[model samples]
Each structure stands twice: as C-alpha cells, then as structure tokens.
Target: MEGLALILLYLAIPGLLFSALQRFLAGKKKSSSTAKFPGPEQYPVVGRVHDLDRFGMWLKFKEWADKYGPIYQTRMLNQPFIIVSDEKIAEELLVKRGHIYSGRPQIRSLIKHKDGPAYSALMDRHDIWKTQRKWCHAAMAEAYKHHFYGHVEMEMKRYLGLLLLDPARFLDYTREYCGRVMSRLAWDEATQGKANGESADQTLHCMSVSGPITNTMTPLWYLPAFANPWYNFEVKRESEQRAWWLNNLRLAKDRYRRGELPNDTWAYRYFEQIQREGNETLEQAEDQEIFASCMIGFLNLVGVVTISGPLKFFLMAMGLHPEWQKKCQDEIDRVCGDEMPTMANFADLPTVRACLKETVRWRSGVPLGVPHQAERDDEYRGVHIEKGTIILACEWSINRVPEKYPDGDNFRPERYLEPGWPTYQEPLTRYPNFREGHSMHTFGWGRRTCLGQNIVDDEMFVFGAATLWAFNSGPKTCPRTGKVIPIDTTATNAHVILEPSPYQMEFKVRSPERGKKVLENYHSVLGKLKL
Candidate 1:
C-alpha cells in the first residue's frame, strides 16, 4: 500500500510538468491553420524553383509581393520558404519570435570552406555564435569609444585624395579604400596600395554573390562532384580561395603568437581570448584554427561587402540631390569648420547622420537579409510555418511600404529631422525621425542585426561629410555632344545588394585651397598612423 501511494505521488507531480511541456510544444506547431498562405503559381514537382532560374530571387520575390501581398509562402527545390514583405509582419516574426526564427538554412557553399559553417554571423544559433557575437559587440563598443571616427577619417581622407586625383574611377577607389581600412582593422596589416584584384575587399565582393546562387543548388550539394559540372568547378575554386585566406589568417595568428598584432583590434582580442583558454591542446587548437578561418570570411562579409553597396548609393544620392547636399555642407561647415569631423563632434552633425540614415533606407543594400531558418513548427497570421522553413525577411519591400513612409520612393533625409522646416521636416515629412529596426532595417533586426553597424555608421559619416565638405557633385557634360549627361537614377545592379549603375557625375573640388588642405590633412593622419 505504501509503494502504491509513493508511485501515485511521483506521477502526479512530475507528470504535471511533462504535460505543460507537451502543451507548449503543441502551441509551437502549426502556426497558422485557418489563414490561407499566398504566393505565385507553383509547379507540382519543381514548386517555384524555376522562378529563381528565370529571374533573380530578389526580383522575383518583389514581383510576387505585388501579386500576393506581403506574407507569402513558396518552395525552392521542394524546400519551404516564407517571405515577409510588410513591416508589421517582419517585426512580428523576426523581432518578437526571433528565438525560433534565427536558424540559418543549410547552404553547402557556406559550409564548404575549411571553417565555413563555423562563421558565427552566417551560421545557426549555437554556443560559438553567441560567444563570437559577444566579442564583436564588446570590440565594437571599445572601438567606438576610442578609435571609431578618427580611424575611418584617416582612411576616408586618403580615399578623398584618390577621388580628387581621379574622380572617374570612383568604383575602384571605393573598393580600395574599404579594403585598406578593413585589412588594417581585421588583420592589423596595411594594404592601402594593394592592387585592385589583390585587395581583400575585391575578393569579398566576388564571394558575396556566391551565397545567393549556391543556396539555390543546395539540394545537389552532396552528389558526387563528377556528376555535377557546377559543383565540381565551385568546390575546386572555393577550396583554392579558402586555402589562400586560411594562410592569411595564420599570418595574423602568427602575429598574435609573437605579440605583434594590436591588442585593440577585434581580431587580435579574439585570438588572445582563445589562447588564454589553453588552446595548446589538440581540440582547442583545432577550434582556434577554425575560428581563425571563419574570421577571414567574416571580415570580408561585414567589413567590406556590407558597406560598399549603400556607400555607392550615398554618393549617387548626393549627385542626384544637390540642395540637400548643400544643406549638409552648410551644417558641416558651421559645426566643424575646416577641421575634419571626428566621433567626438559626431553628435553635433545630426544632418549628416540623418542623410546617412536616409541613404540606408532609400537604397537598402541587402533586400532579403541573409536568409534565416525557422527552428520549430509555428503559426502566424493564421498561416502555418513548418519547422526548417527558410525565412526571407524582405528589407526592400518593407522599406518601400507606402503606408509607413509616404512618398517612400524618393530620397529625403528631412524625414529624419525633428520639429520645424515647413518644406522638409516634421509635419511636412512622413515618419519624421522614425527609426525602424534600429535606424532603418539596412542592418537587419534582432539576433541577425549587423555585427559591424558601428563601423558602417562611421564610414558613411566620414565619407559623406568629408566629400561634401570638399567637393560638389553635379551632372557631367558629354564631351562629344557638349550636353549634360543624363543620369539614370533607377538603374541598379542584380538582386541581394542593390547597387547604382555607373552614372555620369562630375565631382569638382569645392576650392583649390580646401582640396589641397584635404590632401594635406590626409597625409598628416596617415603619418600619425605610421601607415
């Protein structure tokens, strides 16, 4: 009788907790039952996989958004995909339910690199991801306090010197500047004069486009390479690239071993932290090597690839809108005078900040923010989202939503200003000073937000303010016709990162004295940096 009583007690208490877990898991499954999930026509076998083959994923996704409204579901190679285009839906899924929406899709290309999948930013939520993110945040915060604006200013003014010399080669100039600064920050190595293809930035650009294309063919990743031409070629190519990057990573690691790399650099801190954990053991050594490889790719993604697209767009915005450009220059002149803008004085330059913010929103770089995965079965807005479904949080469509941003298509920074400016700010502007997803969704939201946002802000500010202070961007004249070269504001590059076309714009130095002063200041800053 006593034994029976004890069994009953145990079952009654512990079983209650078990039942509660069951109910919780049940709720997580079947997110939406009654609501209809909408999308374009899908074939029986291929589902909408052919859409990607026909047009870029982003372009087709945008096209479908118009037809199917904001929330839609489709399949790629028989895999479930949920695309969120509306701001409300994106916030609901990506922010409120970030825990279940933070997983990364299984992309073979991302994993094929020596330490590819180990890259915390691109990989799924794991212990390593959490650790790396913590380090990144701490590193950026420290950099923000000490070296943020001044370091980038050194790079930007140097970039301006190049721009002054050959404004027509803006493309190469931007690539080189981003490369040099990022190389210094990531590896503590100076690469200011590295040739175009040799710079780390150029390599990152080539790799950036690979992710999108490779993801679509993930269903074929494991088949024998001999059976697939594309697979064989990419594997060999990525292998070679990975080896080169890993060697570079080891060089940086060697510096750390010798106590040569700057202790302040994020990469250096990362290496030092792991080393302190007793990385002499075999497993720890392997982990260290993997992390070193991952960072090589991470720096490329966040440091170089992340900022280039919007940076080009920012310059294009200045060329297209000179009145706003003039106001920005006037504010910079009033606040900073002839001195270069530093992080210490950044608070005073709200106009430049707003302009930078607008550029991010206006021509958002990443349309579908690095696809995330759903970890569990869930329902939203009466629609079902199954476990392991791909989530494309569409930054492009959400930013363009007319309800939130009236006249959203235009580039207007005044919308970010407070109070009065009858023509530009407050009541006259829709969503005045509004900050969505941490000052526009360009950096993404929640767990996937940019690891390098501080760097992005500093780069945009230095480049924008420095250039506006020194030059006037206007339509270039056609040498043959002697007519103003028509600029195509709408022409853009392929999906993912939206880049402006090669538009005709002449950047004239504001004055010879100021131009000379800018170069002189650049030389002085570089000397102080010992570069």
Candidate 2:
C-alpha cells in the first residue's frame, strides 16, 4: 500500500507542474505583446470600463487620441480595443489588409433569433455575408442604372414644395423626403406620397434604445436573461422588427408577382436577379435568406436620419455663414440658370458640392465608425494585435486631423476649393465631386463601407443645390427682443449617429420667381406621379 501511494503522488506532481508552466508561458506572451501600446491606465478586472461615458464618448476618444498618439489600446473586461485616429493607419490596416480586418464584432443587443436571418453587411466576414453583399451590390447597381436619379429628382421637388409651404417643419420634411425616396426605390410604395414613418420610427427607436447601451465597454450584456431587462427588450424588439420586415418582403413579392412593381424598383431588381441566377451560384436560396438580402433596401431607411442630419448641418451652415451660402447660390445660378438642379449640372457647381462635402465632414453622422473585429493575429508597426480585437476608427478625429483640415471645428467649404489645403484638388470646375470618392472616410473604409454612399451623394447634391437655389437660410430673429437667436452647432450623442441639437432657423425664398418655379415643378411632378 505504501509503494502504490508513492507512485500516484509522483504522477500528480508532474501533471500539476506542466499546467503551471503552460499558464506562466501564456502570461508572459500576453504581457510582451501588449506592453508597447500606449493607453489610459487600466484598473484590474474592470480595465477602463469606468472611463466610458454614453454621451460624448467620441469626444473622449479624441481626447485619448491627442494624449496617446494616433493609435492606442484600451481594454474593457477581457476585450481589447484599438482606437485609430489617423486616416493613413486606417487605410493601411482596414483597406490594404482588409482580408484580416473586415470582420464585425458580435453586437449582443442586435442579436437575432438563433435561427433568424441576419443583416448581411452587419454580419461577420463569412460565406453568408459574402453572398448577401453580392446580392445587395447587384440589386443596387441595377436600380441605379434604371430609376435612381428619377426618384431623387421627384422627391427633391416634392420636398422643396413642402419646405416652402411649411419652413417650420424643414427638418421633418427632410426626414420624410429621405424616407419617401428610399421607400420608392425599395418597394415603389411612395408614389402614394406617404413616407414609411413606421420603419423610420422603428430604426430610430432601436438605435436610440440599444445603441448607447451596447456601445459601452462593460459586460452588462453577459448578464443572465433573468437579470437583464435590456436583453429581454431587445429580443422582443428584434422579433417585432423581423416580423415587420418579413411582412414588407411578402407584400413586395406579391406586388412583383402581380406585375404592379416597376422593373426599376429594388424589389423587382432583386427578385429578377434571383430568378435569373436560378441557384446556379447561389448558396442561401431559402425565403429567409432572400428576405435578408433584399432587405438592404429597407435597412437603408436608417439613412433617412443619417442623411437628414447632414442636410440639417447644411442648413445650419447656411444660416451661420451666409457668405458660403451665397457662393453656392451664385454657382448654382450660373450652372442651372433658373432651372432645377440635376446631376447633369453637378460638374459645373463645385461650390454646392463643396458645401455638401464640408457639411458631412463638419458633423459626421457616424462619428465612431461601426467597430471592426480582427480575424486573426497580426502585427502593425511592431504592435501586436491578437485575434478578436475590436478596431474603432474614430472618424470624428480622423476628419478633424489638423494636417488634413485646418480649423477643423469651423465650417469651411474653401478647404476643398483652395490649393493650400490638404483636401483641395486642381481644375476648379470638377475638383470637389462627391461621387468621385472625394469624401471616402465620411462613409467608411474597406469592404464594410456604407453601400448606399453613391445614393447619398446623388441625393445630397440635388437636394442641396435646389435648396440653395430657392431659399436663403438664416437665423430667426426673436420677436420679443428683435435679436438673432444663435444657432448652436452642438450635436446630440444619444446614439452612435450624431445629430445637431434642436435649433430654429428661417428659410426665405431668394426671389419670387424662384418660389414660383418651385411650385410649378412640384405641381408638375405631382400630376405625373398621380398618374
């Protein structure tokens, strides 16, 4: 019995030693890899979690960038995040080495049912994401070739008339116009002149309620279902949204079958592509998969607010800096000459284009870009980045880089017009073209960049040109004091997307002839649309 006990003790001693050695080696490797990076001091376990604030987090990120240099690391719980403030670094890592960095982190609040279809662009880099992205690009390309500009023109005219009729609701009209145009392109349901307000409300609610909560660097999401009310709410919200989207999908499919939907509608183009391919190269051929892919058009309803934010900024800039507005109006008048602005006139109106570019740069909608996840272990400039690290490109900081944009806090379209500025290009006639990739970082970088960028450019140019041509926006005067109310450029940080805090401005027609022309164009389009 004594000999047997001695033999067992010897075996257990070696096993314990081996496990201890493995843990020591792992700790050494982790320490060595992360030692070179600069960041705020981390606390044990919590690891900078307390530093996160729901509001002005991007500002805090920028402050960190100023302190820690362009690239730095921050940890929350066990997750490591790399915050990138320089565009060059972003291009190198996210664009040049995109294959390794194009993955999306798992957003706990946005998780769909275990068996439900997922948003394609939001999904991590995989077979499903690839297939759905291909379908979306194909459908968008087809729609662009057919009826994209026509829809934008019609909607802009309608929006201008609405603005003239009720300038007090300009922001509301902006959102409605965006929603209507997207709805028309997505499902051809906007000819009835009603915006998809419900979808817009759903998107806003989801973003407002879940965005701030999930964006934090805590492990609140890991709480058990019994203890997590947000988790339960999100589950129910996602289920309802799924039903709403699926119902819309069914209605669109039914309309397509009845030949009621136009060939140019996104639904028609998507369905046609599916039929044409006939599963030859398709992997996800199930109804849910098709719905998920086709729903990119519906998902673009999120752009309604995103685009409206920039347009509101444009209005604010116009009111605050009337000189720039006058410059744009002069350019538009020279280019279009009393006629409504169109894509054909885009090249001749560089000032208008520059204003649009500057507005987005001044107040980016998605300040902290959607986080990207590292797919595999990699090294950049001797800094080790492990797999599953979250990469955040602080776009607000990137746009404000002093070297690229001088006086970045102020609104300045001249940056893109003058040769001294980093953003400027030669040949003044066509320098600041939005569609030619002039504002790349504003949308995003690499494969996960916003798919609706081209549409955004087109919509903004036409809407901006027409607005500047028709109205002169300025700060409203207080009736009691007869003083101009200052337009606060401060933005709200309720969600990931940033919008200017509620402000008032007065938009007046530049001339009665312009006002008459706006009404004429609106009535003419209204008649044709009714038919």
Candidate 3:
C-alpha cells in the first residue's frame, strides 16, 4: 500500500509541474506573437538555411537588406528572427519601436543550463538585458571619458616609448596594455592594484575562461558536443571549464562580502546599489546578476582581437608607407608641438585623426563584425527574406563599396575632409574610423551594441596619435627581392576581423628632444596611476 502511494505521489507532482510549465510557455508565446515580419518562402522547420548557404553570405546579406527594405524576418535553428540593416529601418525597429524589439533572443540550451542568463550578446534580450545595459552605460561613462583618462594617458606613453625601443615587440606590448588596462578596470584600481590575492586570481581565471582558449574551442560548437557518444569527451572538457568559471564567480561573491571594493569596475557600483536597496531579492540579483554582467563585459577581451588587429594594421601601414608617416608627424608636430596630444588638441590634429580613420576603414577592426539576427519577416523591393534569420552587414563590403567610397581600397583621409563627408568638420563631429552603422556600428547594432565603445575609441586615438608623434613607422624588409621590405596595406586579410599578416617594422625616433621627453614622463605618469 505504501509503495503504491509513493508512485501516485511522484506522478502527481511531475504532472502538476509539467502543466504549469506548459501554461507559462503558452502565455509567453501569446505575448510574443504580436509582431510578424517578412521571411523567405521556407517551411517552418527549414527556415532560411538554404538561402544563407551561399559563398560570401556576408555581402549577400547587405544586398538582401537593401532589396528587402527594413523590418524583414528570417529563421535559424528553427527560431524566428528580424533583420534591419538600413539606418532608417534600424532606427524604426531598435529605437522608436524599441519596446517590442529591445528584448533579446533567447538561447535555449544556455538558459536551460542556467548559465547565468545566456552570454551570447545576440541572444536573450529581456529585462535582465535592460538592467545590465543601464549599469554598463554608467560604468563605461564613469571609467573611460571622465575618470580613467590619467590611466589611459599613462598607458599611451608606455606604448609610445616601446615603439621607439622595439618595434618587433609591438604585439606583446599591445597585449600587455590591453591586459593591464582591462585588469585594472576589472579589479577597480587605476593601475594593477590587487584587493586580495584570491580576488586577483579570480579575475585572471575568469579572463582565461573567455580568452583565446575559449575562442579557439568555441568553433567546436558547430559540431555536436554530446548526444553522439564520439563527441562526449569534448563536451565534458567544455563542461569542466564552465564549472571553473562559475567557481570564480563564487570567489568574487565572497570578496564582495568581505568588503573588497573595486574602484575601476562597474560591477562594484551596481552591486553596492543592490546591497543598499535593502531587499534580499534585489541583493541576490545584484550579486549574481551583476557578476554575470561583469563576465559579459570582461568578454571585452574577446573584442580586443578587433582593436589589436587594427592597431597592428595601422602600424604596418605607417611602416610600409613612410611618406604618410612623415605627413602625419608633421601635422602632429604643428598642432601640439610635443605637449603630449590631449583630446583638446584632437580638432587641430585633423590630418592625424584622418590617418587613424583611414586606417580603421582600410583595415577595419572587426571585419565580419557581430552578426545581427532578424526578429521578423520583412521585405524591401522584391527580395524574399524570412523570420529568424542571421544577417551580417559586412563592414568590409560596405566600407569598400566603390559607389559609396570611391577608390575604396586606397588610404585617403582627404575624402572625409570634404564639407559633407560623414565625419566632416562640424561642431560635434564623430570619428569616421570607429564603426559606421550609427556611432560606427563596428561595435554592434541595436540593443546589443558594445558597451565598451567609449574606452575603445579614447584608447585607440590616444595610443595611435601618441605613437605617431614619437616615432616614424616603416617596414624592414623588401617584398620582391627578399631584402628589407615595406609594409603594404593591401596585404591585409578580410576575415572575421581585418588584420595585417605578420610583418617586421622599424620605429625611428623623429627627434632626440621628443625621445627624451617621452622617457622622462613615462615612469612619473605610471607612478601617478593608482596601481
């Protein structure tokens, strides 16, 4: 009798939970079904997979977006998506109609595993996204534009000095700067200040989890991780790494409890607010959710490949093309006269700015950029696009579009100097080089744009200008004769991110006076940093 009763209880409990889950999902479906966008003529199960299988799908997406107009739809993984590429169309959906479109797409497996609310920026647009974005904006604004200028300048000086000493070590220097600057920001100090050894270790571990290791391994997702017995081992390895990352989060949580405050990171501010609210639920959300958000933000390192890639391209371009280097240095010398180029002097240094802009355009930081998934099925002209599709704007294609930018492959800063060019002279001019779909969508589009855009810009500009001012860049070997070559911009790869192939370069100091000045200010500036 007792055994029968236990069986009945088990069945009843599961049935109740299943019924409740069904009802919840049904309500969610009803709420989300209000909008319908255009899509390709494919059965629901197959969606737009056939259409996107073509070679150079990147270029094809822009062509389709133009043909389909704004507010189109498609599908992927049997999910509905909306695509908006034109500026007006993106504005309509992501801005004016933001209430409906702001919600991020959901990743089922990720959320099912409760991986702290899906890390894919392309997925999971919800209230959590809204909350995290709010905190991120505030944090970026506090650290980059206003608060962290001193640290940024110090790093810029170090980078400039390195250019004079060892050009071959450029990659290492760039990586160190990226690591240290990001580390400082993550740990909340102006420099390499550690609140505690465990906390610092936690930060490092969290970073390594998402670093190049995960990057190289992530493509394995294209293959089956489990289910197939042959793939089980790889899946287990990924699982182990994920577990380690979660443990690091727990360590961060403990540090928070111990009053280990971070002055540089946005997490500290948001978590503090959570604690101050005096609500146990909010406090929990603040601790866990905020930690999750920082992890997301720390994914900035993933995007560093974008910045570092282009910086090297710019350096190589300078090294190969000595004439352009001389022209830029002359302009810099005329404008700032060795005062260490500040943002205030940016306007006077238009030519210098143009070089950076042209560098970004010629060899964009992120060539493929983050892909935008369509939320609805929509059409422009006569193209047939379906819902739940993945669309790419292809920055390289658009930036190199001969019609929009004539002689697109050549590096010409003068084109932008014209009266009506996008970044032309204006009281409030935006940098043309950063990203171009709106604040240069190089960061991203719509609700999932990069939160670190401000710092990325400031650091790139500061570093680019400072390095040019300190030394003249040129290639060290000859291409044809196998002798000393010159750097050539056209040799860059148009991949996920545009970067110059490995090349040697020489950095010759423009003047002894400037060299001494950079050397004198380097350590003092670093000393002032609250490391």
Candidate 4:
C-alpha cells in the first residue's frame, strides 16, 4: 500500500504541474499578439520540443528559416522564441534597439547556484554585467596594446612545432594553442599549463548539458532534488567549476604577491583595479564572485573552444580546398618570404585574410548564437514580441543568405576578393580587414558583442598566416586503396559551439627552410622565458 501510494504521488505531481502550465500558456496565447508570425506547429504541453533535434537543432532552425521566411517563432514549453535569420532584422532588433533585446534567456539547466549571486557576465543581470564588461574591456585593451601579440606569437610558434612533430595531432595542437594563449593572457606563464586543457573540457561539458533540448525541459527543475538528474549533474559540475576557478585564482594571487606576474596580465590588472575600487564601487565585491566572473567571462566563455572552432575549420579548408591553400601560400611567399607571418604583415597578405574570413563565414563557432531575451514588450514589422520572449540570431542561416553569398554552401575565399561578390571591396591592401565593421555576425550583434573580438581576430589571422606559411595541408591518401581519404567538411560535433568532427589530413612542411624557421622561433621564445 505504501509503495502504491508513493507511485501515485510521483505521478500526481507532474500531472498537477502540467495542468498549471497548460493554464498559464493558454492565458499567454490569448494575450499574445505574435500569432501573425509564421512558425512550426506546436503541440500542447511540449511545444516544439518534440520537433527539435538535441544536437543538430541549428540545422533544423535553418530548415525552418527557409520554410517560414526571415523571422519566425517557436515555443519550448511555455517559453516563446523568436528566431531571426535576416541580417537586417538582427541589426534592427539586437543592434539598433539593443537595450530592449539584450537580456539573456533563463535556462533552468544553467541555474547551478540557486541562491548565490550570478558571477558570470553571461547572466541576465544588467548591473553586474555592466561592471564585468567594463573591467574586461579595460583589461583586454591594456593587454592588447602591450602584451597580447607576444603571447599569441609564442603560442603560434609552439603550435607549429607540435603540429610538425605529429601532423596527425593537428586538432589537439589547435585546442592547445587557443588554451595556452588564453591562459597566458588571463594570468601568466605559470598558470597556462594548469588551466589550458582542463578548463576546455569543463566548458564543453557545461555547454553540452545546457543546450537547446535540455534547456526546454523546464519541468525537470520542479522535481524533488533526489529525483532530478539534470539538477544533480549541474550541481556537481558547478561545484567542480567553482573549485577550479578558486584554485586558479588563489595561485594567480599568490604569484602576483610574489611579483612574478606581469602588470599587463589580466590577473594583475583585475586585482589592482578591484583593490583600488572597493565594495562601494563594484557590483561583485566578494573574492569568489570576482574570480569566477573574471575567469568565466574571459577564459571559458570567450577564449578556448570558441577560438579553436575557426582554426580547425581553417585547417579543414586547407585540406578540402587545396587550390585556395596554394593561392594563400603563394601570396604569403610573395609578401612574407621565408619568414613566419605576423600581424605586421597582415595588410600585405590579403589572400590570407580573405581565407580566414571565408572560413569563419563557412562554419561559425556558434551556429545559433547565444539566445537573447526581450526586456520589454516590443514590436517590429507589425509583429509583437513579448517581454520574456527568447531571441536567436541564427548565424548558420545568416551566413548562407543566397543574395549575399552566391553558392554559399561551397568553400570559396574568392568571395571576399573578387569584384562582383557581395562581400568584396577595392584596395586589396585593406579590404578584407575585420576591424572595419565588416563582420558577418561572427562575434555577435550590438552591446552584447563579444569583448574578445580583437584578440580572436588577431589570433585567427596570425595562426592562419603562420600555418599556411609553414605547412602544405592536403587530403591524405589511403595506404591500401591509394584513393584520397575523403574530407567531410560538413561533419561537426553537435554542441552549441560548432566544432569540426575530428578529421585527418596530410601536413607536410612546405620547405626545409620554413620548418627550420619554425623551430628557431620556438627555441628563441622558449629561451626568453625564465621557466
């Protein structure tokens, strides 16, 4: 009798909750003025959750965009989402009227600390986000001016050496390159090894559990703590993440006290700034909040996995489209000439720049960008968007706009260089530059745009140029079949951040001289460091 009673109680809870949710949604639907917008047909309680794929939801979104025009609506349970594929709509809503559309959608799976203060800038809290953004901008600006180039160059050289040693491990080296550079910039050399790969695993794990399908299942959060798997997993990961952040923070602070860290490093700058401006001026005065916010905003959110996506795409592009690879190498040879390329040579290497731009457009890191929430009821094109409606600017669809990019499915660096393409411009020396507001929605839109764009651009540019200069990447030939090993450029991991499904390629040193130059630069940088 007790067992039956317990079973009945468990069943009754969800039934009662579902009834309440149905009533709430019915009221919302009656009041909603957004019915005029085209959308996929949604079921009663689940909304469109049944229609969406867990990992490949971005592809489904692109398909829906094609069927329903530029702007469309979908629901996940009681939450309404507005997906914008048109760049103009994105610009108008997310950029022009950013104040109304910059709030982050509340994902129940991501709510690890129910009662603790939100420490990530990714949260919806405006005041704390403002303070975090200001600190990030100031520190990044100072670092870029004084220290970022050296760190990137050092990492690029190390990356090249690692790739040359074991060409099959290019993907691993790409990840390591992004991780080490971010670690160095965030703290110092001492912390780079400890923070690089482990943080990446944590970030990816967090993203995996907090994706579209998991986010939509709001009922999971209402269950008892013992019965809730999502809540339990999130709690465990959050605790591990917090411990990692605190440990790194303690190490960095100890190093700072010893005068071992550079003044331009983000850790040094952040510590100095907080000490100068105490609790009265800051939103996050607690040490744990401060450390978590800095690390979460800078390293985990913007740095490692985000940068690795494009770099891997670039490598894939080289293997799949060797013609473009040769074009870029020829240009590098003409301009850089037997030396590894640097930011100083960026202006003269338009082909290299175009290839990098094309790679980003071809495979954006975040296909469906981080969702933004409407802060107030708003109207655009005679359509009403409610206060809490989630907004997604689908980067995958935006990049494939037929009118903007002809044959958008194919890899073509010439689109940015040729005369007639929509992306092209004159004055070859400066045309393909990312700094001139020519972004194709790669970073993001408006005030919420990534603060790490400058660093990302620099890293991509230098790494692309140096890699093209050092190695000739081509499709590997099978030993037995003798046929070319096929490259699947379309294959990607299904996380929110789109990473190429691991693939192999043949990376041969372009010339002995170039290989020697990479080795010399690696050793030279190593000698300069006291370690």
Cα lDDT of model 2 by residue, 214-243, tens digit:
434224555578955657877886666566
For each candidate, what TM-score against the reference?
0.82, 0.87, 0.69, 0.89
Q: Flag the better candidate by TM-score, 1 or 4.
A: 4
Worst 10 residues of 4 by lDDT: 112-121
* lDDT tens per residue, model 1, 120-162: 6666787767766777678677776765535577777787887
Error of 2 at 173 (Å): 0.9
lDDT of 2 at 153: 90
Per-residue lDDT tens digits of candidate 4, residues 1-531? 335434544465566467758767765875666445898997765578666776677888999999999999988666788999989999999999999988876656766322233334366645556666676777777667753848788778878887888998888888878877777776665335435655565555555523422454555456688866657887776666666666566677778667786775677777676678773333444575544544543454357777888889989988788888999999999988988898889789999889988888888888888778899888887776778888999999998998997888888888888899888887888878665645547778888787777787689899999999999988889999999888778787766677788887999998888889888887877765423
Model 1 misplacement above 4 A = 1-35, 51-56, 112-118, 192-214, 217-223, 227-229, 256-259, 275-287, 418-438, 526-531
The best candidate in terms of lDDT: 4
The global C-alpha lDDT for each of the candidates, from Candidate 1 onward, is 0.66, 0.73, 0.54, 0.74
Looking at model 4, residue 437 earns an lDDT score of 42
Worst 10 residues of 2 by lDDT: 209-218
The Cα RMSD in angstroms, rounded to one decimal, for candidate 3 relative to the true structure is 10.0
- Model 2 earns a TM-score of 0.87
Clashing residue pairs in candidate 4 are none
A best-first ranking of the candidates according to their lDDT comes to: 4, 2, 1, 3
Which digits, one per residue and each the tens of the lDDT, describe model 3 over residues 1-531?
335433433444444456446644754664444444554565433355445522234455555656664446655324445555544455554555444443333222121212233243434565555555576577667775563635667767776666666767875676556545654565433233211222222323222212222211222223344422213533453355445444445555566667775544544655566667784333454457545644534343343454666677777767766787887788788888977886666656666666777777776665544555445554434443344344544565556555456776787776666665554544324434353322365665566677766666666777777888887666675556878774555554333444455667777777899888888767666555553
